[model samples]
Target chain A: MIIPYLELAISFLRVSLSAYGGGIAAISLIRHEVVVIRGWLSVEEFIRVVTLAEMTPGPLIVNTATFIGFRLAGVPGSLVATTAVLSPALLLLTALMLAARRLESRGQFRVRIQDAVKPAVLALMLMAIISFGRNAVTNLSTALIAALALAVLLVSRRKVHPVLVVIAGGIAGLFLL
Target chain B: MFVVFFRTGLLTFGGGYSILPVLHYELVDSRRWLSEQNYTDIVSKATAIPGAVSVNTAFLCGRVLRGKKGSATAVLGMAIPSVTTMILIAAYLFEYVHHPGVQRFMKGAAAAVAAQITYGVWLYARSAVRSVWVVLATAPLFAGAFFLGLHPLLLVATALVVGGPFVYRKAKLKAATSSPESEYSELME
Candidate 1:
């Protein structure tokens, strides 16, 4: 158990470190590792975890890591996995603080790096939506609900609380689906 | 600062960008730990880092406020509530999340989630792909991800290595040619 937990720790550390452009972009890498490579989770289960991540309040990566770690082992697994994923950010934060003062003048280089990564990140996000949409949008009612929800979010610019949207979607699902 | 970030973590919903409002209110508006200008700078810098945006924001703010220890405290405080909630869910309600009823709820919620993610697509595109050349270059990558079964990890890694320097050169050229009007001017305002 400890050995497997350590492996999980290592995997999450690698994933979190390589997860450029933030959590949403990281979802693809996670799916690749846990689903494609490790075979720890199926596509459906992975999508479900993605949903859980979205609904939760914390970081998507952390929430998904916790769930996967728990499913793999237990409480101890969860603790180890959480620590592993978070270690990079802590290390990076320290390095960033140390280097930030010296590197402050090179702001353009930093901005451009972010700019170059944006399109790829956007592509990954689109893939996530399409893949999940294909799975979730099975019937007419579900499709309508999805389109309506997309419209609502579009018009509102996601200002409305997400929990309300989830609740509303659930009620609609209960009645219609 | 620890208490403030803990509250921010506990109260925030939807994660990432959702914490922005709460952090702004407490750090900028209420406590005056950061001025509006400083807060904006923190946000931009946080976004530039990898990992979670909200957590990075907390970490950067903490470092700015105190030091390395402050960063650790802020991250821990922000993480505690969410981690506890997640672990509790895993312990008590894991099975139920996969039950028929809850799965149905997730089905609907998943659709909503998909919608929200679509909005993210546009949001990032607006910020990143301002030129036609970028769109043309990026469209193929998007298509490859969608159609050709290209892995996003590979795609993003390649983008970072290849595009990083390309964009840097472009920015430098643009800066050299254009007046020094300030790239961060919009953010400052």
Candidate 2:
């Protein structure tokens, strides 16, 4: 039990440390680890996991860590993984805040980095879309469902919460699609 | 303050960019924890970082409010509610999620997720591609990631290293001529 718990700690630690761009972009890294490498979840299970993460409210990555950890070693494992995943960011951000205090004059430096990295982050998100789309859009029906969801989200401009959009898609799948 | 972040965590429906409106409403509008500009600063910086955007925002906000202790408190407040709920949800999901109807519904949910991500692509692209050069340069990047199937980390690094200077030059040039005030605004807050 302890062994699996520790393993969950380490695995999620690595994932949280490595994942960038957050949200769906981080899902790719989690998929590569949990689904592809460890075989902890199969492809279909992975899709379900992503869907579950989307449907529920919280940080997607943290929710994923908790879910995977629970699957590995129950409640304790979930706690361990959550802590492990969060610790790095806590430590890094604290240290960065400390360091950044002294280098207060370097204001423009950070802006340049932000300007530089924005497009790359955008590209990463694009990759996530393509990869997930390939897996989810298996048939014309699924494709139409995807298209409808996209149109709603785009047209709404976030006026509609995504959870509703997801539920609508599920209903469409059940009845119309 | 802790309550504010806790509420933000609990209220954020879809995470990532979803947290923005809640933050805008609570911290910016209601409590006035920070000005709109300061809030945007925290958000953009949080987005640029490698971790969860909501967590990052909480950390930065906490830091600005008090210090390390505040940061820790805010992070815990933001994470705990969602973590507790997720454990229950995960346990429930593991049980009957194997049902055929449930599976089909989830499949549809997955397709919606793909659509949701595609929408995110449009939103991010609209914000990030500010100029013709950016559009030109990032097109190949889109191709490389979508077609050639390069690792995301590799692409991110290559873009940062290769595309950084191009955009920076453009931004600097525009800042010098057009809007000198806004150029350094990102870091000042």
In DockQ terms, which candidate is top?
A: 2
In model 1, the runs with Cα more than 4 Å from the true position are: A1-8, A17-60, A68-74, A89-111, A157-159, B1-78, B177-189
TM-score of 2: 0.73
TM-score of each: 0.69, 0.73
Clashes of each: 0, 0
Please list all clashing residue pairs in model 1, or write none if there are none. none
Candidate 2 lDDT, tens digit per residue, A40-153? 889888887776776566778878887888878888888888888777876776675567565545533433444565655666666656656787789988999989988887
lDDT of 1 at A126: 62
Model 2: residues >4 Å from true position, as ranges? A1-4, A21-60, A93-110, B1-78, B89-93, B166-189
Instruction: Score residue A91 of candidate 1 by CA lDDT.
Output: 77
lDDT per residue (tens digit) for residues B1-189 in model 1? 788888777655446654554576677656789876566556545554567767888887898788778888989898888888788887786566657776676667656655554554554455455688667767777888878878656766666777778777876776566554664663243
Displacement of the residue B60 alpha carbon in candidate 2, Å = 5.5
lDDT of 1 at A51: 72
- Which 10-residue span in candidate 1 chain B carries the lowest summed lDDT? B180-189
**Which stretch of 10 consecutive residues in model 2 chain B shows the poorest summed lDDT?**
B12-21
